[model samples]
Target: MADEKRRPRPAAQYGPTAALVARNVERLRKTRNLTIYSLSAELGKAGRPITPSAIAKIEKMQRQVNVDDLLALAVVFGVSPAALLLPLEDSPRHTAEITGAGAVPADSAWAWASNKRPLKFPPGEQRTAEMEYALASLPPNAREARQHPAGRAIEAAYEDVTRVIVRAAWSVEGDEHEFIDALDQARASLERTLAELGRLAVEHEELVRLRDGVPREGSD
Candidate 1:
């Protein structure tokens, strides 16, 4: 058996988020007229040396991006890392006049397009219980729509995605087969995480009602 075949797959810990990032990456890269090869060369000049193929994989969500990759991309695009991570709605506003690929003033061409402030979590391993506690303590009424376990899982999953992207972007020696397998497993885990969070939310609400001395919908 070939070593590549024997190795585990790449985990898709941040599958959807990675896919979203990839779209943004592609969109922004195009805005700057960068081909995949050009982007690869730029990264190589910066000591990262991401191959065109790997870049393709990332954009396609078949691979991941790491912290280093994100940083390099930020530099290449002349945008903040936060800009790269911001939701699609916050991507640079496009105008027909600016669509032709020539020089565009950064200020007028692209501003973080979000009306609301985005949540800022500590990047990488620095995220700890303090963050979780803070998230949990947000007034329940204030967060009733999105402060659920599913939302937190999505946030954590985004972090995991950045890690996976870093690994896939920087490590060229790993078994490709195993790396791909890891991605598959990670994606599965994310799906399960979402499902489990939904189940827990229902149970948690019922428990909260009981603890607070509230009756069930049909109580005597």
Candidate 2:
């Protein structure tokens, strides 16, 4: 075998990383339609005092971000603190769901019911955990398409399959067996939605890769 020397890969510049994070901060600020003044004010409200010019400097990559500043910025942006620091770009979140009875009319009654009475979920089951499971399966960047804006639409779809609307209406009159069936259906729907979300996440991997200037190796 012939001895061959391997070529060394060039290191990426820090300018890009700083510039990218700055660009992201500015993009988020602009997309949210926030003025530098407003952003500064908000940071103040979050108990961090910093000038808008400081934010601008950070965005221009002229200044570095401290832990408190980063945390303050994250609070203003409604994103995770680590997200602001990562070299990769993050996709926009899902659409916002309007909370109203028309969307989930059956459960709508409970909106006020819980206000009047103490509600207790059954043993060996949890609401937040189960819902989080469904949510966790979703893309880190949820489908922001018209059909499924907020990730809640996925839950809404599951509700449809489980006859959540009907179940809520009939639950008072129906037997435990009927309610159980409805929950079963809901679970199945959640399972299916989770699978779909997983697929989208894999597809979204390309978007993240692109940010790092990583090319698709197989494409000639």
Candidate 3:
């Protein structure tokens, strides 16, 4: 197993503010051998102009870190935000490889052939739900009814569709392509649904802006 670093203090130890977020950022970087210079350079190339000096300052807790910076760092490290947060005791050790195996690829194939399966997302169902939510948020002029109704009916309809996606995905879970396909299906469907919803919402949000001299609080 890889050497596990000492976990940091939980936010409860510091309260609702920044807490140990910076420390977690630094720790994760060190754990992955991602030097401040390398990470910041990567961030810069990715269109967020960040300097190594700035990265160092942020890690030292001398500079404030915003959500965008934190998010960029997390993505670079390929870790969940929660992992960089929420202090834990006796957290299980993480190891990326199974040792004592023959060729790694052969071992991977063997593992894939084993009982475990991949989980898939239901493209149709997810889109339906997002669309329904979007439709409900539309203004009276946008929908036949004055106010958009809750998309419960669509959600219920998509339940079975989602189930199929999940079941199918479970059949190929460990394989990267299959797993990614499952994720992509969910993401793509929902995003397209959201785009449609956003267009409709924009219309309603716009009308509210026009109706009242002062824009509504929820106005886009």
lDDT of 2 at 103: 21
Cα-based lDDT for every prediction? 0.63, 0.59, 0.54
Cα lDDT tens digits, model 2, 1-220, are 3688877876434444355467768877887899888998998999997798988887777776677887888888898664454433211112211223122222322322322111233466655543444353434444233124234547555445546555665678865676678778777767777877887787789888898888897976
Q: For each candidate, what TM-score against the reference?
A: 0.39, 0.34, 0.34
Model 3's alpha-carbon lDDT is 0.54
lDDT of 1 by residue, 1-220 (tens): 4665576876777644455577778888899999999999998998888999998888887777888898899898898775665443311223212222333323223331221112333466334533454456545653443345676566556545544564575458765664576576568668867886888888999999989999888879
Best candidate per lDDT, number?
1
Q: For model 1, give the RMSD to the true fold.
A: 21.0
Candidate rank order under lDDT: 1, 2, 3
What is the lDDT for 57 in model 1? 86
Worst 10 residues of 2 by lDDT: 89-98
Clashes in each model (backbone N, CA, C under 3 Å)? 21, 2, 8
Candidate 3: tens digits of C-alpha lDDT, residues 1-220: 4698878855322322244566777878888898888888878876676788987877666676677876777687787664454332211222112222222232222222231111112565754544454455545554333223323333333433453465465556565565456556666556555665677788888788788877567768
Worst 10 residues of 1 by lDDT: 109-118
